[model samples]
Target: MSPMILIALILQICVTNVITGEYSEVVHNFKSIRKNVALSILVIDGDESNIDSSSLSSAEFVKVPNIEDLYIINILNSLDKNIFTSLHRLQHLKIEENELSYIGPAVWAGLDLEKLSLRNNQIEKLDNRAFDGLKASMIDLSNNKLRTLPNKCLQSLRLYKLTLANNQLEDIDLETFGPELAYADLSNNLLTSLDVEVFSGVYALLNLNLSGNKLTSIVAAPTLKKLKVLNYSHNQISVIAGNAFDSYNQLMELYLDHNQIFRLNHQSFPSIAPIKKFTIDHNYLTGLSDELLNALDNLAYLKFGGNPWSCKCLERVLEFIRSNKIGTDYCESKLIPQGHSCVNYYDKCYGNETKILSQNFEIYKNFIKHYEC
Candidate 1:
């Protein structure tokens, strides 16, 4: 499953067990909640040896040992050090599609997990005391083949949700991410850039996915003003500097959509950001600056469809995104130009003519000679 690790995301325990023969003594129920242990050991199809204690030939876990959510799917390939030291109330573990490559530190010696799932797997390496004493607060080492990381490896966990999306990460050391990392999924991976001071030790972020990867630009970050969901869609972004997001104003979902943007000004952003849901959509944008359309007047949601606009100086922000349906209903028969009017460049069709921006593609009309009214 390698095409840069597609996700696995396990956890769907629907217990039943209780067959009582041919290697039984498991006993889970799940509805009336008897749960005497048998928290999913689905060996994808059994036999090949690797999981110890004889694949847990259930001595009934030494008699009903109140286990807590454990699911060891698609079996065998490594991991035997301690192998769940008799589930001391295992606080949720997942161990995905396996062929575990290595993960010793006596495999979480005295577990303290609050959710850990070594997704997919073939772990390329990890044992900087592989989680010294567990203390996990959600860890999913996405897929795997992990390349590097050891700044006190997870600075003694206090994590609050970190996925390390698809692994083989190119660079990360968010100062050993802590301060209650509030959800981060370094999407895909092999990030090409990101030193916004590695977010000054995660200032309580709320979701930040650097989608796909190989980012090209989007810097400014006043330690991310408590981001509320930010995804730099796909990547290869074409510069988006100036306060790129320093004031985010508690952003509520913002994606820059596929990149290579063709221009955007008015100090780039923050006319008092109150973004509710926004997308820059396919890129090469050609207009928008009535103070970024009045800072998108609290859009409940909007996606700036493709782009190449300049539709008569963006007729009042495309009539306020086609009268608030948000995302222009097919831009008047597909991207304007069927008799539209807003006279001269800045005589005002929503002031300063939203910045006369129609360099009709030819890669920016050869040398940018616009005005196709």
Candidate 2:
């Protein structure tokens, strides 16, 4: 009962309508509300240039044209064909910071819109029937100025969550996506390359944000039998091709943090044995080969703080990160775990009654030690 007091009691019984001037004052502020007292969010302060489907066909002087969430603060460039055929119980449509270039194909044919945000728009292009009769679950064209992605303007949608993050998208036509995609935010954008024909369509992709983007290498990909999160982090990646995740078995999180990964290949995560959250922080690693640390086993988290660790084999990778406490404080919030002059030096146990340096040993006099008897 305390999520900020249930969001302040659902914002005190949801009711918002910020309609601004001109454009016939949005049907004179929907004829001063009162058609069965309704309004659960319908902010419309637009008219910076256009938006006139004959002024929403004066939605019967909408006191409650049954608006189902529709925000349009400053709609600019275009969109006026059937502009929501009299808002038939419209279903969530936000026209963010507009500079919207165009959107024709009968401007949303027969609306059943579930959600559609033209996020920050400056929309560069989108033609082939721009979205013929949009059916949505989610479509936030993040930031926008899309460079490419026009294979029949998102071939007949029935979207499933597609936010083309920040944008200047370099390429994308994963078979005109739509096999009930589960989530596909193409982060940052300007993708340098990637087209292992991503699972030859039939996508049910489970979260695939190609983070930052300008990717250098990570090719091989093929069988994404329902992928489960693969955010190829800020990139310029230096190779990670071992069939770059043809991994099925619902692959769990795999982020390759800031990249240039100098090396990591022992059949790179052979079928990621149910991997759990594996990041490769900063990158350009100087050491890591215990067969890629026993092919990363059951990791709950292994962020590998920044990289460059080579004091001639930094204690066998700090003895597998201190015998598995593996939490190098992800980029510091508290990290004191790094050693070199043959750090901690451990190796000795000859039965009968053994006890050596379990208590005191701090030798550093022109030091040089190694004992195996």
Candidate 3:
């Protein structure tokens, strides 16, 4: 049978119900249905009123014997401690856009959940044992009022993806998450710096985004050996340690643009054998060393525009781009069709002088050799 026919057959055989109202009214409506019929899915979108927990205490009133997914949204009052304790077979639970600010530890004790999303709420604190017995693989707590992650808040869980973006986070304890994390986003917060030991146990981490924050530096711990993509853009970074990326052997793309960086040391990068794209545009950089140019021998895409480039220093970079045939459309000039020129031209170099890199290679090479760093 085709997939559509198979889905239709399944829908014909299964029973699904959607309940929306105040919690007491939904329970009354659910009780109106015939007993002993297993429910496949239950979605309860609460009205903007406090939940009446007393109405949901009995199994006959609110029991969903075989529910696979449950979504409850816009609940106004705090959750009872045993609200989800009876949902032993629940696989996915989403309770979003509510006024919930805290979750007790034992609320989700027996759930066999796989994904839990509490997004767009007023959550400010979570107990350490809040997620103790869940089989959750992904947790999203974005757009909340969270200022700090409690210690061991995510301990002993099997989460592979965690999103804590757009919160008021100022600092995070490293021991909050486990080693099974693969993707984490902590952007758009108030973090000033991250401790190097924060990622010591996350060996499986691949993508880490810390953009749109107040960070002043890019320091990577030695444990991020498998990191592939790192985004540290839109920060206040002015200095990058030379060995900041020495441990990232599998890094593929690095974004350090939109900062205040003026220079990069020769030892700023590790082996670039696997790097495919590198961007440092929109900064205060005036020049790049020959050693740094040599390190980017394998990069495919490079962005060096939006800077106040010195004419003499720009000549060396142009020579490297010409000799290696680095394919890029950024540095190209509109006036001269031959080669690229500085955006803000200095008196020492003219717009037509940039063409010397390709037209007169030896003379340009000699000229760059005599120029000092």
TM-score of each: 0.32, 0.31, 0.76
Q: Write the per-residue lDDT of candidate 2 for residues 173-277, one digit (tens) a residue.
A: 666676677788888989888777743664587888888989897655555667777888998887677766656456777888787675677676764556678
lDDT of predicted model 3: 0.70
Whole-model lDDT for model 1 versus the true structure?
Answer: 0.64
Stretches of candidate 1 off by over 4 Å are 1-105, 109-112, 115-124, 127-137, 140-162, 165-184, 191-208, 215-230, 237-254, 261-276, 287-299, 303-313, 325-373
- What's the count of clashing pairs in each model shown? 0, 0, 0
For candidate 2, report its TM-score.
0.31
Candidate 3 stretches greater than 4 Å from native: 1-38, 46-62, 312-341, 344-373
Model 3 residue 320 distance off true place after TM-score fit, in angstroms: 5.2
- Positional deviation of 163 in candidate 2, in angstroms? 3.6
Q: Write model 1 residue lDDT over 1-373, tens digit each, in one string.
A: 7543433222112122224322223222211123344432311223344433223333334343556665655554676566566667768778687678778775676778788888887788887777876777899889888867766677668889988788877887657687778888989888888777777766787888889988888756676678788898888786676668756777878888777676665576676677778777566665666666676677766666555555555575656665665543343324333344533322322232223223324465543355332
Please report the TM-score between candidate 3 and the true structure.
Answer: 0.76
TM-score of 1: 0.32
Ordered from best to worst lDDT, the candidate numbers read 3, 1, 2
Q: Put down candidate 3 lDDT per residue, 124-180, tens digits, no spaces.
A: 988877776667888999999999987877857867889999999999897866899
Ranking by TM-score: 3, 1, 2
TM-score winner between 1 and 3, please give it. Answer: 3
Pairs in steric clash, model 2: none
Candidate 3 least-lDDT 10 residues: 21-30
Cα lDDT, model 2, residue 316: 66
